[model samples]
Structure formats: structure tokens, C-alpha cells
Target: MMKLDPTNLHRIDEGPPSKLQRLIRRSRRRRPSTDATSRMAARLASAGVFAAEAPTSSGGPALLDGVRAGGATLRRLAFGVGGGALALVALGAAWSAWQERPADRMSDAVVAPTTADRTGPSALGTTAAVDSAAVPQPLSTIVPVVSVDELPSTRPGLVATSSTRTEVRSSSPPAPRRSESEFAIIKRAQDAVLSSPAQALDLAEQHARAFPTGELVQEREVVAVEALARLGRKAEAKSRANALLTRYPRTPYVVRLERALGEPLSPAPSTSGR
Candidate 1:
């Protein structure tokens, strides 16, 4: 056995640390290294970050501004189109209102003629110096010029003026009409026009002389024209037809008369040769 020493014996008493204490020292030693490596990695990650991976703090405001601008532009476009449509509607309404104005319609309405337009100049202006003789009498009051046989009988009677005195008066009856009614005459002439042309012509002439202003004057003229044509009086027929054309250009008889006159004449066969 070796000789025992005091220093060696103290060193053995404080021999190598225990396993738990060694582990604690080792963890303490590794803590500063791990902290420094983590800080370095954080700085590197922040500094060397890619532009695509970078975060923008101001991006929220810029996106909101773009959206607001787009909305404002759309709002302005919508307002512009809506305003144009409203303006067109207003213009059309104004035009319709103007066209239907009552004053304008009243201006176009027909007005009746005044009494001055109907009355002649003599009846209107100079009534002061006008004579009763010159004043035209009504046609109903005028006694037509007729023969003595056509006139009615006259009766003479005495009319008392005051009770004591008597005045002699004569009352003549209404005159008898010699001319036939215009309608009857025109009908008779029309009935006789084709069958008895000479009699129709004579009746028509008589009607013209008797009732010059008759309502059936045109009918009488038509009957006369047909009768003259049937009687082979082409010259008189053509003359009367021309007069009818001048008077009643749009008459239905005009077409008939024109057709009759325009008929082609047939050629007569030679009697001596045949």
C-alpha cells in the first residue's frame, strides 16, 4: 500500500462533479450560444427577405382608395346617363305640352261668317236715301206675269171705315199657275226621251222657258241631250254635251254621254253593188 498524504486526501474529498451538477453547467454553457444564434437568424430573415414576401403596412389605405375611386367613376357615369335620359324626357314632355296648347288649337278652328258677309252692299250701307221702290221685294210677294185666263176672279165688296162711312174695296184671289211642277215635267221628259225623242225635246224646251231656275234643270238638260242624240241631231247633241261638260264636269251622266259620242260609226255597205 502507498504512503498516505493530506493534500491527496483533500483532492479526493472534492473529486469530479456529480452527473446532475455537470448537466446543469453544460446547459448554462449552451444557453448563451443558442440565444446568439437565434438573434442572428432573426436579423438575417428580416434583412434578406424577398420583395414578393414583404408585408406593406400602407397597402390597406391604397386598396381602399382604388375601390373608392372606381365606385366614384361608376357613380359619375351612371349619373351622366341618368341625367341625359331625364333631359330627353323633359324635352319630349315640353314639346307635347306646346303642341296641345289651347290658344294654338283655337287659332286653327273655323269661325262662322258675320251678318255683314251675308248681306249685300245695298242692304248694309245706304238705308237713309234708299227708295221703297228700289228696295227689292221678296219673291213670294211678287205677282208673276201671267195671262188673263190664268188669273183668278175678283170680288168687289164694301168695307165700313168708321160706322157712318163705307169704303169700296176689291179682293182678288190667288193667280192660277200655268206651268207644271218642275219634277213632274222632268220625269215626263225623261220617260219620253228614248221612245219619243221629238216630244221629249219639245217638253225640255218648254221646261227651260217656264222654269229657268228649276231644281231639275240639270235633269231636263240630260233628257234633252239623250232625245237629241236619239233623233240623230248630232250637232245639237254635241253642243249640249259640251255645255254639260262646262256646267257639271263631274256629273255621272258625263261618262255615259262621252261613251255614246265616242262610239265608232259602222261603215254602210254599198246598195248599188250588192
Candidate 2:
């Protein structure tokens, strides 16, 4: 026998093998022995796992329907699990993006405001305090002020002399009065002279007897003369009137005497010297 090199085993193909090795290689190709996978299938068949002839209930049409339904159910379950896994992955990515946005916004909020505040530190304390003006009051009318001394009742008083707030007396004392009895008797006869001359003459005579030298005696005589003329006693009226004129030539009863006498009395002689 010749020795072969161990390091160069591929060179063995260069030499021809004996006849038995040739026969073994040819038989390996002709009728091959069982492989690892085929032997495992054979063992499972012997254990009756793949035996189709085992004696049990034979469901022909119903068994075929059950097999078809079970295959469709398993396919739907696989599709559902695949879709759910895809949805969960998408949701996780979106949640990570959403969580990052608020941090970015907070950083922007902290940094953006200082750039807009361009006014200096001098902007705060530049203004001074101020006071407001008072409201105006309403105007009133002017009242003339008068002095207390101006009132004759206040002997010695201040002389207030402005048109402000003054008060004064606006009235005076009344005139002196006359006697009622003596004046009234002659007055009644005077009022009655033309209407009731008879009553008037009687009242006149009563007055003369009562007040012979009364202050209103001239008026009484004038009333009596007018009463006499009214009673158609012209002669008596002329006589009393002449007596009246002779007593006081300047008597104010001259007009009454003339009216009763139905003629004018002669004017009194001139009292002034030439």
C-alpha cells in the first residue's frame, strides 16, 4: 500500500478508489437511506400521530366544513394581531412627539419676552405727582347794604355802604289826627246839604248852638248858608254869606257862598300898598 498526505485530502480524488468503494458510492445513489427529517416522520407515524386509518367516528361532510372554518379563523386572528401591533407602534411615536412640544414652548416663553421690552430702566420713575383743581360754586344776586345809622331809629350806628347784605326801613311816621266829634257833626251837614236841605239846615243850627266858636265854625256857617239857599230862602242865604265874608274876607268858603247866592262875591280889596 502507498501512503497519502493528510494535509492535502482533496488530492485523494486524483487517485482512483478500489472496486468496493465504487460499489458503495453507486448504491448510495441507487437506494438512499432515511435522512434525519424522514426518520422523524417515520417515528411519528409509528406512534399513530400521522396514521389516517385509526378507528374513530367518521364525519365526512361536517369534518371538511369544520376544517375550512378553523383555517379562516386563524388567518383573521393573525391579521388582527399584526394590525394592533402597528397601531401601538404609531401611538408610541406620536406620544413621544407630543411630549417634546411643551418643553419647546416653555423654553420659547422664557426667552421671547425680554427682547420686546426695549424701554430703559428710566421708564419707571419719570412721572411726578399732581394735585387736582377745586370745583366752582354758584353765583348769587347782589343785595345793597345800608348803614344802621341811615335808619332814624338807630341813633349812632355803623355806616354800611355796599350792595351786599343790608336791610333798612322803607316807611315813615303818619300825619297828626283831628278831633272826631267836632269835625264829624259839621261833616254830616255838609254831606246832606244838597240831598236833604231841610234836615241839613236843622243839623247846621244844632251844630252852631253846640259849638259856637268851634274850630270848624266857618265850615258850619257855609253849610247853613247852602242849606238856606236849598230851602228857597235866598234872602237869608245872602245875609249869612255877607256876614261870613265880612268876618273873614280871605275865607276859603268864598266858592260855596257864591254857589249858594247864585252870584259871585266881589273880590276882596287889594291888601298890598301901591
- Model 1 lDDT tens row, 51-120: 1233444653222232233223322322333222111112211223324444422221111012112332
Positional deviation of 234 in candidate 2, in angstroms? 0.2
How well does candidate 1 match the true structure in TM-score terms?
Answer: 0.32
TM per candidate: 0.32, 0.32
Q: What C-alpha lDDT values do all the predictions have?
A: 0.43, 0.45
**lDDT for model 2:** 0.45
Relative to the unseen true structure, what is the Cα RMSD of model 2?
72.9
Residue pairs with backbone atoms closer than 3 Å in model 1 (clashes): none
| Counted clashes in each candidate structure | 0, 0
